[model samples]
Target chain A: MDKLLVSKRMKGRLVQNAILQAIFFFATVLGLIALMLLLSHVVMQAIGWLDGDFLNNFPSRRPEEAGMKSGLIGSLWLMMIVAPVSFILGVGTAIYLEEYALKNRFTAFIQTNISNLTGVPSIVFGLLGLTIFVRELGLGRSVLAAGLTMSLLVFPVIVVAAQEAIRAVPQQLREASYAMGATKWQTICRVVLPAALPGMLTGAILALSRAVGETAPLVVLGIPTFIAYLPSGVLDTFTVMPLQIYNWTGRPQEEFQHVAAAGIVVLLGFLIMMNSVAVLIRNKFQKRF
Target chain B: MGIPTNQEQPFSVREMIVENQRRQHWPKRMEKIAPKLLFTLAALSVLVTLGILFTLLFETIEFFRRVSIVEFVTSKEWLPWNEEHGSFGVAPLVTGTLLTTGIAMLFAVPIGLASAIYLSEYASERTRRIIKPALEVLAGIPTIVYGFFALTIVTPLLQNVIPDLEIFNALSPGLVMGIMIIPMIASLSEDAMSAVPNSIREGALALGATKLEVALKVVLPAAASGVIASVILGISRAVGETMIVAVAGGSSPEFTFDVTKSIQTLTAYIVQVTTGDAGYGTTIYYSIYAVGMTLFLFTLVMNVLAQYISRRFREEY
Candidate 1:
């Protein structure tokens, strides 16, 4: 009788285990379903609208005549400024905190401040851009202003990633350099930077890709949606791909929504390319040591 | 000591040391300069924080000069358009933000925690690898796309079932934002759960506990602080999110708790005001800064609280 009771209790526990496991499994399934729906829905709408004309022409009142040329060029110009500036600033900050800064209140404050900045809403950064870069500096919704804003927005991401990469460098490498009587800069330049390069590059590329998708900040900068001319310089007024997509999506017509989806496909294509390059750098160049 | 003997003069160490130091003088100068330069770069981040603070503060103060602080805080309406009869109370926008965030959390916490539990305790390494990056892809998709998805697809689908839903209601954006943040919460909580020692699970199993029981009672408790921290961070993200709400959360500023009705979040309001030609120095223009300051404070408090919980309640091995 005791054995039968034990068997019954064990069976009950097994049943409970299966139920909980299924529940957990389905939770992941739900998220996957949402992802799949979003992709398929966008792609299905973008089927016929994504063509050469869509990429070549400027946006017009008519859907078929509309293209993302100015938006694409504007985004390109913005990245021209964002890529170099953010990389230099981000990697520099990472190197300082990891290799140079003494452990003290000031360094600690900078670290905490960076963490807090990452949590600041992108729109707040937009407000910052509007006030300082746009109004105070008189850049006036130019690509330079937008690019600098995006750089600050993505700065924390690159810094944190680069810091992780720098921290992951083995201490033995630095010790060997010190043993050879190498100065701090020599040790860093020779032993540490090379080891950390792949990770740093990956982080910078991913951050750039993120900047591509950012729309709210650009919108808040008051970059008008219908720019007929391409931006030739940093100071030229510009609109980005996401902002174009945003404007299109907000329109009352059905064709504009489809056009927005096509724009999204192109934007996603760029993002996928960037992300794959990041993965390739991580896999192909990362040193095992 | 001053003069070397004839035998030692051929290899004088002092002369050689001086020659090498002089040869590397440029590098030595650069070494001194590099730290200061990098420090300046690092300090720029602090300047950014100060810029954001002062810009918002300066304008918000200007906004308060026009409208009393008490009326701004206590009033229910937000009508910056009607400057003469405008009610500058921030309550409607705050309520709208809270409503969307509440709905987002309601959906995200359960699914995200469940997915974290599955990934940490149930899935094999292969399944985890494949699923993890896929979820990250979900996270990587832009918020603007999510906004489009909510407006174009989700709303139409929801309208079929929930007939009372407005064309641009809070429910669609709230639900879509919930989907957007799921990956964030899942990945963070998974990292926390994975940090729990395997020995704890072993001990539970040795005591005749089932796998579910072990995960529920042992690992979950051990990783409680981390999971909570992740959820808090997710809440902050939801609170600060702009485009999704701006796109689908509607533009009307109303003081309603109903998710089916049109409402405007603080972020959506900022977008609305900024996108319009709110001429510089106008009440509407300054109001964006005031609204932005409120959003900034909300996110800052949540972020600090998350950091405190994670650091304070960490379970060290």
Candidate 2:
């Protein structure tokens, strides 16, 4: 009886272990499968729309000739504006909080609020942008307005990241700099800022990548569904890649679906390239440290 | 002897003089300026939050004046473009938002929590590192891509299986949104699980518990608060998700609970009104603010709850 009981327990344990292993294996494989499905679906549908004219021409009703040139240019313009503004404001706030502020209730309150802001729905930021930037400020529905909206949407994220990067810099480094008789400003600008630059850059890259892929804020900011011309200025009305894809996908025409897939391929490709560069920079910084 | 002593104290005199001068000027200056700078920055962050609240409130109030609050809240129909017969019932949008978010949480929490358990307890260090970055990649995929995936791929697959699925239904979008948020829950829960002391695991194992038992009975219960917080945050993400719902959840504003039919979320409603030809200053245009205010308030509550739960249950060793 004792021998039978021991063997049964061992068998049950083996079965349980096997089940646990199977669950983990299944999860990992599911993740990979989702990724593969994303890539393959886009590629298979995009190939039919790939041609020379598809790269240079403006968006048209025809699938064989419609290109994302204007949408691409609009995205570039939006990034150019959003990146600098968000970076400066976000990094500045982080430096103040992490380096200068005393640990007090007020500062703690701000910190908590900032974190909450990070959790606030992206759509809320869009609504805020629509009310404040678009209507109250009279920026109108333009690239500048969209960029500003996106900047607000990502501001909290950048600040949070910047704070983390700044916090990760060892206190010993600051002490050593102070011991060298450096002024607070000098220490921050010359020693601390440089040391934290790589992390800050990575954060900025991540935030920008997020902004580039964002569709909700732009959609709420009144991004045009179709724009045949490239934005000539910051205030020029424009369409983004996601909005264009959205427009194409919603059409009943099969041809538009192909174009939408092609747009997805382009958007994903851009995201991958941006992420790769970020990874490269991060690795280089890691090696240096 | 006095002359020799005075000469030997040269270094001390120089250091004392330098320190006295620096302390007199630098410390006073830093003490005066640093607090002010810090206060100003902190104030700015507060101002941003206040600004968002005020902006949403003012516009939302203006919107309510045009459309009665009772009508906006109780009506089941949301047709802003048709001014001749406009009904601004926000219930359907609210229901749709909640249903989709519920579906997303259902998909995200279990998978994410399980993945977190596997990573923290079962996986080797090498596997942990690999999986961590892979999960981050999954998190970093743009919601827009997820939206496209839902519309083009998941929708077609569902149609094949269900045979009656609409071109735009809630299931595919909710599923995709769930997938997008899974990484968030996993990463946060993993952080919580990893923070559990190894001693706890060892104790459970010593009691003849299997690895799975050790994980489920010890680590999960210990990390429950953080896991719950992560789930709340994920739901917040799903509720705010716009593109997927806008694309895959269809454009019809309906209050039905059926996942196979077209629906519209609060965020998607905002997107719809904004994209269409709603003229500036029109009641329809102002209705976006009303919808946005709802979304903002809902998310704000979730966020506050998350912060409260995280702090209240925060464990320290």
Per-prediction TM-score of chain B? Answer: 0.93, 0.88
DockQ of 1: 0.85
* Count of backbone collisions in candidate 1: 0
Worst 10 residues of 2 chain B by lDDT: B1-10
lDDT of 1 by residue, B195-225 (tens): 9999989999999999999889999999999
**Per-prediction DockQ scores?**
0.85, 0.50
Report lDDT per candidate. Answer: 0.93, 0.82
Q: Please give the TM-score of chain B in predicted model 1.
A: 0.93
- Angstrom error at residue B178, model 1: 0.5
Chain A TM-scores of each predicted structure, in the order given, are 0.97, 0.95
